[model samples]
Target: MLLFLMSLNFMVLDNIIMLEYNLLTINSDMIVMTILLDWMSLLFMSFVLFISSMVIFYSEEYMYGDLNINRFVMLVVMFVLSMMLLIISPNLVSILLGWDGLGLVSYCLVIYYQNVKSYNAGMLTALSNRVGDVALLMSIAWMLNYGSWNYIFYLDFMKNDISMMVTSYLVVLAAMTKSAQIPFSSWLPAAMAAPTPVSSLVHSSTLVTAGVYLLIRFNFAFSNNLMMLLLFISSMTMFMSGLGANFEFDLKKIIALSTLSQLGLMMSILALGDYKLAFFHLLIHALFKALLFMCAGNIIHNMGNCQDIRFMGSLVNQMPLTCTYMNICNLSLCGLPFFSGFYSKDLIVEFLSMEYLNMYIYIMFYVSIGLTVCYSFRLVYYTMSGNFNYISLNSLNEENEIMLKGMGGLIFMVIFSGSSLMWIMFPSFYFICLPLYLKLMTLFLIMLGMFIGYEFSKFSLSYSSKSLMTMNLSFFLSSMWNMPFISTFGINYNPLKLGNFYYKNIDQGWSEYMGSQNIYMNLVNSSKFLQILFSNNLKIYLLLMVLWFMFIMFTLF
Candidate 1:
């Protein structure tokens, strides 16, 4: 909170402080530990600390009676420390230390449960993030050509360099993997295998957004071509996650998918060359999304660890406080006019309206926005309305005051952070003039999406239902367009197949026959022959020698 106050003061005073500790100097290069204290870093740091603190408080009630509570708390603290390192560092080297720390610690959290599903999910999360780690390392290597590892100092001047351009591409690739964009997106939903508190902290603000923050930091170096490519991928990610969420049944997975969708929105805005808007959305998103997860956690806790929304109904009657928090977050996530999400989301859409983007991007942007609303309303219809469909023996109520209070800290921010952030982040309003139809397009899409949600919420697996007719398509969307399969078995198939072939033809087959095994057999045969000659054939050898001498004399003649 003090850091947040300091950020406000820094913004008001327009101040930046840099402190460098010179660690080692080799010729013209110096290895320095750099700390940049500006509104951006301070504000981001403050938000991390705030969300992490809230998540910890929420975990108290959520993880109650767990045997490994101390270990869990320690892991969460280390996770926050890693994010703090990521937030404040401008150097690629130090950022990577934090980046890897997040991957490692998240792997620990993801497999927190002693179950096969958790183990699989942890492996998926770790390996997916490994791609980004390698990319960042390659970028660090690329930056070495500039005589320094401090990328912040060289970003502007090094833009024209070929090596730096390659670095930019690597950096973007790294961001994509970390942000779970398109091909790397399977991990985000899978990571819901972790406890909900981990999801609140990791998905909402820290682990996933690290990519966005890194890209925002490097936004100055991107070419137009790269920006267009990034826009396409991010837009697709937004569309994919939103569509997937509608078909999803798991409460945590649905929320996780929504986080994926919002991340795509942020990445797209950043791709549009508006980092502040992305950052603005990032801060507001952290508040509400964190609270959203907390509400989901409370519900899951009361439901005896059940996460399927299909089994959840009329939750408003039993868990009124939890339902209230969840509904507010749902509305905010949909970007309703007065909510915090609306401030950032509305400005982004309106701003995009003014840009000269192609038809594909424009359609993608609007449709994705609709899909986001579509799924949110569907989730609301299933979980908040209708009759209770869960187990008859279940006890559902919001008696956990710790969880409620934790969520309460963020609930106000969820409602007001957008407006407050807009006031501070954008001292002057943007002058965006567009056609009335264009201005109304976004509102129209939101309404249409809500209607679709209502309709879809009525769908079922009954014999008469038409949804079964399109079962394949529904399965595709619900399964993330088969992304998990593709990322898992599909990705591993050819490599594993090749390995099998090598094992048959080389490692176990020809190599065994002609290499060590073959040589051993040959040596054994020769030894047997020598042994026979020396031990048993001595008398026969004398007779053979006399016969050989006679034969040799005849041949000589």
Candidate 2:
């Protein structure tokens, strides 16, 4: 209720509120904590808080009977707080506090289940995010040259400066990692090891979008060259995740990859200089994505922990509400007309089509959009239409009032957020008049994707000889192009091997023999000699003193 009111207030007032405090001053430079609240932050914050509230409410039933429920809730609360800090802060240093907090809390959440898979996933998530953390720290150091950590103020000024351009590049690098673009994307799907609520919150609103929000805030610093590079990478990320989602069978993982793909869309649109549209899509995506995860959680809870799509079927008859909500979210995700996604997605496509971009980018943009619809419909058919494939003893029912209530809040937003935000965010919508063929390009691709998805979902590839013929390709797509393995084992393999080498040759062998072991052996021998000499009594001591005196006299002579 508070978030709804806040959203309304921000929409009506459209005000900017700046809050700042100087933490320290050094050599006439101020290290300050700053919060810049405008329509963007207020609208995003309202969405974040609302989605978080729903996720927490849903977790009440979804995570019921767990011994660590309280801890889980606290971690989630902390995650929300960190995200809030990230959203409000305009200062780089202050943003780091939130950024690092998010990485840490998300790591904790990912590993909350005390299993090997969760542990590995948590490590991958943390280490992958640490790349961005380092990049952000570097950006902060670079921004120090400007005398203030507030990159928001310096974005336009720094555009022409070479050194600041480097900082901008660093900022983009950081955003890429946090947003899970390209090499950094492996952690996103792996992070589905976390509970569903965490998936909904982190994947949808807070964690993944942090990068997009950062890029949106720093859009002023982006050069033409930089934007092009960003566009290429973001397009690949979108296409890659979309393809990966199509191959995925895990319920939560499919959604996670979809989040990744949407994040790429957000970044790509931002690169296209439509930060407002990117922001619009981010918020709308959050609404449906969160609700989508909740629906998945409800289904997972009812299906005895099975997440394979093959195990789910005819859920529309068995669990009408869950299916209804899931279908709405999925359709919205597909950018169906009149849904929240269509408002922002349609605008982005139209604007892109009208832009003078190269064929590569144009193709990627349309193809990825089609891929989006493809995986979504494929998911819908497999989960909602087929015959039930679960074991005989499984109980599939939607009797959880708390879960339904949690979803009830988001269903309204999922249906209306895009339209409402369109009016509020862009009061004067400019018409982009395009040729009929160009205008209908998005619709054509969407329909084509649906057709392909329907055909693909109708048969199991495993039953065909072509499955063996394309086993390598299937494995690549299903494994997200071996990204999980690369991020998990590939990242650690060399480091672990180096550490082992050092332990064997340096710490245990060379360093031990030359330093600690040698010193210990020398000390032991000396102690033994001293004890033997001391045991020889006063006569020996007197003789030694006389001999020492004679030797000193001889040396002096």
Candidate 3:
């Protein structure tokens, strides 16, 4: 721990010294920064460090009996380093390089459990991530071919032509996939195969936030069709994930789905061009989510990896410290007043009011928040308030001292930093902070969710499992309206089938067209030069061609 602090101090000192010497200057196409120091980046970096340390500390105790402690420690440090680099990156390419490193490390860590389930989950995440990575690469290639590779490239692409439109759509698709937005949201819930500490780091604090960060950073490109796409995608993702979380039985998967839901909310806020709200929510979500995942970890570790909350009950008595921390974190998740979530949640709604079309979005956002409260409270109550029916595998059952201390310290940090940092970031938030009526409204919604969750606890399932519920009713309802204005309304709903329908019914003049093309095909096929060019000696042909050009040049001289 001392060595870790010293390393942090050295990085800070290096950055300070570089700034003092004016060693890092802003390019003409770059945003000015004092050695790339900015309030937002600094704040995000602080969260990364805090959470990474807590997770490391937690793992020291959580994995004490496992043989792979060294491996875990190495991956944890690499994770921290990669996130720090990503947070401070000054250019898009540099940011992407950092992001790739982060994805690689996170994928490796998610499967650290080395079980079949974890292995499959890790592969699924990597596969989805590869799709996003390819999209990003294509976008980068397009941007470099047209606009400059500097920061101005994003600024210049807003009014560019058709290519820019295609590139922008591709980027939005990639961002949604990376952030685990709807349709691509299944990977995250399955990612619960990871241990709780890794889940906390990836889902809550670092990698999942990358998509929102990219969207907010590239708001200059939000002008064209991209804005509408983001709004729809974000709305659908939030609405669906909220319902998904409601039905999930695993304690970890519930939080995982909630992460996707909250990320969707942040994306929607960004779609409205409210950068502050998006970033503010990112910070608050990171805190509460990290705390909650750690608490879940504590519960699971104590129960010898019994993941279903259906079997966990009356934990408040057996694990008072974990319960207290869980309650506070749950309150934050529930968005109770004076907690961290309250400030950010309210601010986002206020920002929504400023947009014309955003009122409906605000309604949906609040509904999702209510759902968030419901799932969060359900998670806490089900795992802590029921009868203690669970049996510990080890007779001398207790949380590791190191793990408890780590978790307790993280909970304290969340409480302290959550409120104070909000004030520091946006002092204006202090005055317009939810009015008495709005506070009551928000509180009422939260209480309604708690009531539902409380009622839900009375009815128990005979058998419950952690994998995500096979189907989501809310998702079906929300997506039923997405047929593109000509399918169910006037055209075909199945795009692929439409292609086959066209081939079967249209273009009956195929033979005449083929006959006309035969002469051209024969002329090309009869060319000896072309035949030679297609031979394996194609490289030699190219060499002879170059020599002929040289001979022609000599004769002219």
Candidate 4:
């Protein structure tokens, strides 16, 4: 553990020392500082090392019996290195390189279990991350045409308009895809098939954050006109993921969605130009999220791989230490008072209440925060309390004492850290403190969620066909909340049958527009053009011959 910490520090120093030449610098005309290592990036970097180190120590015990422990450790190290490289890279090109490497490392780590489901999840993550990379690459390619690509490198990117309208839109798409926003979020839920430590790293401090980090890296390009777009998209992501988390049954999926929603909150803060608040929240999230994920891993390890919370209950009595740590972490995630998440989460809300932004955005932020509390508590209750039907009491074995000790240490540190220990250690990092009453209010929300969650657990869940039918009926009824007419008149009705009845005489009508994603796929796979251009080696040879002939003719002429 000491060696690991030392190595982590060494890695940070190596990066700073090696990349010193290309360190951040300001652009000549831009108002933003060109190259600056403000508190935000530094703070995020600190969290990365902190959470990653925790993962390594926890895994020492968690993966003790596994055969591929060395590979796991190596990949974990590589993953950290890749993320650091991405975070500290000087130019857009280096950023892309590191980003791609991080993506690949994460995919490899996800499938480390070597099962069909794990492989499938890894593939999904890869495909989605590829979409993000393609957007980033396209932006880089655009910069190539304008001669400004090299001029705005590293932290210096803050000083130039490297992103034009098209590039900005593309980068935003990349951010959405990378952050698992909206429709692109399907990949993250599936990503639950990975080991829990990987989930912690992916969710808390690493893979999922690359896109938002990039956005922050180029804040100058976005600070003026795109604030509204960023805010709307981010808040909507928070709202959607929070609601979706409420509906999730898988423990890791719930946490994964929570990760996305929290990141959306950070993005929202960034959009509002509250970089300090966003940075603090990002740091605080790393602490609580890592704690949460590690606890989940312990649960999975102890319960012999159970995932669905519907089957779990009475675990608090069985694994008291695990339960205690998990509960505290859950409280933090719910933004309870004196927990790290409280101050950070409230700070974001405070920024949103600044009156210049749309009132609804502020409302949505609070609603999402409340829903965040709801789902986070739901995660704890469904997994930790109730009937012990799902968990095999006979089969359950408490995790190693060392693992439990690590979790305990984290909880204690976060509690003290949240209070004032961390502030004493780094006074410069503290931006603005929350009011005591506001902190109490944050705890009130958490306590409210705890009560609601407790009430929910008292009712025995019935999986009988009748109960399932009721659930289906309820879901069908509630689906109308978002777009009532679409749910009632369009989706519930068989569009295929309706179109068949009407367009039976008319060729494909709605399907044409409906399959635009497929159309994009088709355009991407246009083999006919490839065939005409290079299907045969003869075509390539002939083209080469013509080019040579033209060259000779031009020389002679």
Model 2 steric clash pairs? none
Worst 10 residues of 4 by lDDT: 29-38
Off by over 4 Å in 1: 24-30, 463-469, 507-510, 520-557
Model 4 residue 78 distance off true place after TM-score fit, in angstroms: 1.1
Candidate 2 or 4, higher TM-score? 2
- Model 3 score (lDDT): 0.73
lDDT for every model? 0.91, 0.90, 0.73, 0.71
Clash count in backbone of candidate 4: 7
Tens-digit lDDT string for candidate 3 (256-305): 87888889889988888777778888988898788888888888887878
RMSD of model 3 against the true structure? 12.7
TM-score of 4: 0.73
Please, what is the TM-score per model?
0.92, 0.90, 0.75, 0.73
Clashing pairs in 4: 24-35, 25-34, 25-35, 26-34, 26-35, 90-154, 311-390
Q: Of the candidates numbered 2 and 3, which has the greater TM-score value?
A: 2
**Best-fitting candidate, measured by lDDT?**
1
Off by over 4 Å in 2: 1-14, 22-32, 463-469, 499-557
- Residues 270-361, candidate 2, lDDT per residue (tens digit)? 99999989998999999999999999999999998889998888889999999999999988988888989999999999999888989999
lDDT of 1 at 545: 95
Model 2, residue 394: what's the lDDT? 77
TM-score for model 2? 0.90
